[model samples]
Target: MSTFDEKLKLFAVDLYKINAIKFGEYKTKVGLITPVYCDLRVIVSYPQLLNTLAELIIEYIKKMQTFDIVCGVPYTALPIATVVSVKNSIPMVMRRKEAKDYGTKKLIEGQFKEGDNCLIVEDVVTSGSSILETVKDLKNSGIKCSDAIVLLNREQGGEKLLSENGIKMHALLSLTQLMQFLKEANCVNESVVEKVKIYLQNTQVDPNVLIKNNRLKLSFLERLNFAKNPVTRRLLQVMCDKKTTLCVAADVTSTTDLLNLAEQTGPHICLFKTHIDIVEDFHPNFLKHLKEIAERHNFIIFEDRKFADIGNTVQLQYSKSMYQISSWANLVTAHSVMGKGILEGIQQSEGLKDRGVFLLAEASCAGSLTDQSYVDATLKLAKQYPDLITGIVCQNPLLLEEPGVIQLTPGVHLESVGDRLAQQYNSPETVVLEKGADVAVVGRAITKSADPAAEAVKYKEVLWAAYEKRIASQ
Candidate 1:
């Protein structure tokens, strides 16, 4: 039997053919005339193919460790999620658009605890509005949606929207990947592939169009310039559209270890997050070295201080404090738990404009206190101070109502349970993909592994599988 990776490669090639064969002149839901159409609902008819597909997805999930539950959206995704759940011996949840008054009287029917983390699975994403709605329903029922996995992302605005709203999205096959697969399989001519590329290019040419309704629009290039303002660009570089890789703590005990890991996982991640309080040894020399490495590796350094104080105190922490956090760190994590005034203090500092600040809204740990009170308060604060708050770190996927607040989730682990000597988080690829996480904060699995490079490859493979599965479904 072929290894999962080989099978996945073959499957992507087959899926590309299926998509190309199915493609024809068609009108999209948005009324755009297109030369191709992808509806993965037909894949269910081929039991063997479907089974292999499910196995591929399960393989990625198992690699991350087992999850507590797998949840699928209404209509198409339910069957796929069901197969993965059954095959992996995990429970599954379903989110209905509206409450069913007849049978269950339920909108979200599953065996989930109020704070239980769930991975939301979907077939495909176009505009991402439907998934956001699903996330809202999941949160309303008191479930934590930290990650989302899909079959295909059309390289549309969905990824950005999901990321902006604080959900990390992973795809088994992205549009680009699928197109390449089609080219390799000879299913699509170069002209058709070029058309798809043009479609994506045109879509991204204007960020304003993507968020016109929300009145929030800034092209990635524009955002890059915005990030470069003398105040902001020095510490952080917003590499990807929405996701960020953050260094968790900056204490001397783990700084070197964390920086080393960040360098190894650079291209796969976006931001390097850190908490200054954890650093035991503070020195200008260390800062200089770390900054140099960050530049060399193409990642941003985030200071995850979770700052919650008055303006003067916050200013002191950023500028003249003992740690002098503003000197080297690019992004900062703060708690909106205090309100808008606290955010204003940090945003007003010199050389801080480009420095994105992630607000703590919903957090991932087992016993986080992000209840309804916190959600309401955070949403209110988010609206009042949108400019200062670059993103919100929340476990609740529904908390992504507003734009500009980049959602960064930590507590990301591939293994559900660490070996006998270590504790496990059981975060499967399915969970991460379904919940629509922006950037997953992974440590032990990558750092503690005998081969960090291999461990990183495992994550990239699993993530790629999730992306492909989503695309095939779409």
Candidate 2:
């Protein structure tokens, strides 16, 4: 009998020989473009490799627990489960991706009692969605499933997600192990290995960190892991590191006042929103100083330019005008009323590196024009430009159907009910905790306070406290 290492080496050799493991640009099920692809289904055509894989999985599972029946996830793992069951003399059950329309309508096939313990088998695990779906089905049928075994673990939060749901995960080979074997065997080049390593590091999602610091729901984190927008990710990272989801709306008119507000509130905010065009003393030096303060305090400059115009006009307004808003602002606001062309225009800006846009879905002012139809259209347009649109500026959180997009609630104040200008307000607890807002945009509450810096700290603490409470309740 060969050692586990010896068997794994031979299996890797066979995998490359049959072209089951290919090196190229392949998009994963979670929408990540990976450098290497592992098609486990190809193993079925090679009987020797299939048997070796079953042996490896059975050996790996031996350390876990003994179960009454083994259930394969679906189309791909059924054959592998059959091989494992026959060779080990273990009873096997099968789960249908979709039950038959007419006969019996049973989702699970084979003989199993209500209290039987079933082990889930899978070809590969990425986000563990398939395994979770299979577990849901088995649980509904009153069968116990406390363990799952997979041929390959992509190391992309699958283990953490499964463990959170009370199921232990066992894998025969992880992506790191396979990469190391391939590199040692000279099957893949150094560049391929490096690319895979980089991708894994960049895309790896830690549910614990996200929940602990960011206070984001697990379901939201799963989608956020696959988001293509770098700026969106950066915003979330800044919020976590700063421990604040407060965006201070600097509604002042002079550069001095704006810069003062920024300096005072910068340490307590993830974003310093501005209306640069509205600055009475706007100049090149103002932006330079503002950017310096932003970098010093680890906050992003958000230009609240609710651009609503044709593509050509907006493009010039964003990049070419005297303001040149794209040169410093990390994020900008836009109205989807103009349609996809607005996004295309923003994308055409020359200095638009690592920038994102938030679409105006609803307003907090009295008698605002943003209706349900307008919000639906805005979200629909935002979806078409996922890489550009990172969030929706709204009064409520209902517009957030996609977990990848965040919600920013404006007009948040601690005590003010309604301003003379018809600006309504909500408390930090109400917006961040009850409304599920990612960032509570507070304008007058912080900007108009006597001690702006002290006021900023108050709002930050309240917002973060509410966020922690919300996640704890969840």
Candidate 3:
């Protein structure tokens, strides 16, 4: 390998020797399940090893970038910072996790004054919460900290979190690098390697540190088109006109009953969702009547096709399908796993500006595989085509509520009862009042009720009240 690789390997080997990297089934202090646990605190026990680690950190920081002062993130990073400051002749700041009332009563202990930029140095990172909080305190003190350097990145959400928050992080080695070095050294078995890989794949943000906003950031142009998108604009209009934030999910399997259901429920709903393929006897003629009813009733049709294929195939499926979905459906749902190409295919339709897609960002199941990676992918796609991605079908309202994108939630029930399947049900109030969802999609709650229209009205009342309360609270 080259010099850089050599140093990385050396650092990994050194970390292993210190028992800083342990192989076993253990839960991190932050509750991250992993086959390997990292605690660089062990380095301070051996004087020579501690100095070696400090030198490594110093070298890594110097090679990565420059800073006006070095700030250690409390207890674990203080020793390393001391050595780096003494060796490199750099100024340093120490931040205490809690300020002592008897002492200077200062949260920060250092000679560096306000306006001096600092490079945050940490031994290892899991969620980067401490770093973020420290950065917050540093900023509060008027000191600038724009970059951070960590010895080991657990491949967790920390690096991304810091970067998103405007602070860049440079790591000497990642979990993948260290794991590979250990495997090559014959320090871990095949099972250990597999466990670590699995853990890393399923690893999500620790709930406490998961950063999110109440809504999405919409561009001025997208915001202007917010009222132009037929589906979203109509929904907002329904909220304004009818004072409701509920969308009736008419998932019946018959075209005639589907039309009847839309006509019956349209007065109270802004959108009517359907699973077109499930309709027992579907035809192009069926859509002709459906569109007429939709126009007369002032509601949009959302085809829950969940198109999961490639671009060309999905485009054909959307445009040339027997039902002629592209011509009739106002909005369509697509899985984000297929990436942007799937949506790109649907966007290639004749009415590009008029149509939009709801990317399924979250699954309403008990133990779904969807995680931060999936949510991030969905957000990336939505941000790419803000106008086209009208909204997201997600349960995490805190992060998914972008300005123009509506939050379409499913598995809603008037009562707490759920189906025999794994699908979970949330109350309309829970989803809207608390979670910030713009629209609650009710299926059996409305369709199977004694009175579907009355049920629709009930959901509209609760959801609209919750929407008003949420807005008032905000």
The CA-based lDDT of model 1 is what? 0.63
Cα lDDT of model 1 by residue, 92-179, tens digit: 8888754421355577886888877777788787766667767877886788886778887877777887887787887777888777
- Give candidate 3 regions above 4 Å deviation: 1-230, 351-353, 398-401
Per-candidate TM equals 0.51, 0.55, 0.55
Question: Candidate 3: minimum summed lDDT over ten consecutive residues — where?
Answer: 212-221
Model 3, residue pairs in steric clash: 215-401, 216-401, 216-402
Q: Write down the worst ten-residue block by lDDT for model 1.
A: 213-222
Model 2, residue 399: C-alpha shift (Å): 4.9
Error of 1 at 255 (Å): 5.0
| Deviation (Å) of 382 in candidate 3 | 1.6
Q: Write the per-residue lDDT of candidate 3 for residues 285-346, one digit (tens) a residue.
A: 77878888888877778888999999998998998877678888879999988888898899
List clash counts for every candidate, in order. Answer: 55, 0, 3
Error of 2 at 189 (Å): 56
lDDT, each prediction: 0.63, 0.83, 0.76
Worst 10 residues of 2 by lDDT: 210-219
All predictions: root-mean-square deviation over Cα? 17.5, 13.0, 14.9
Candidate 3 lDDT score at position 44: 80
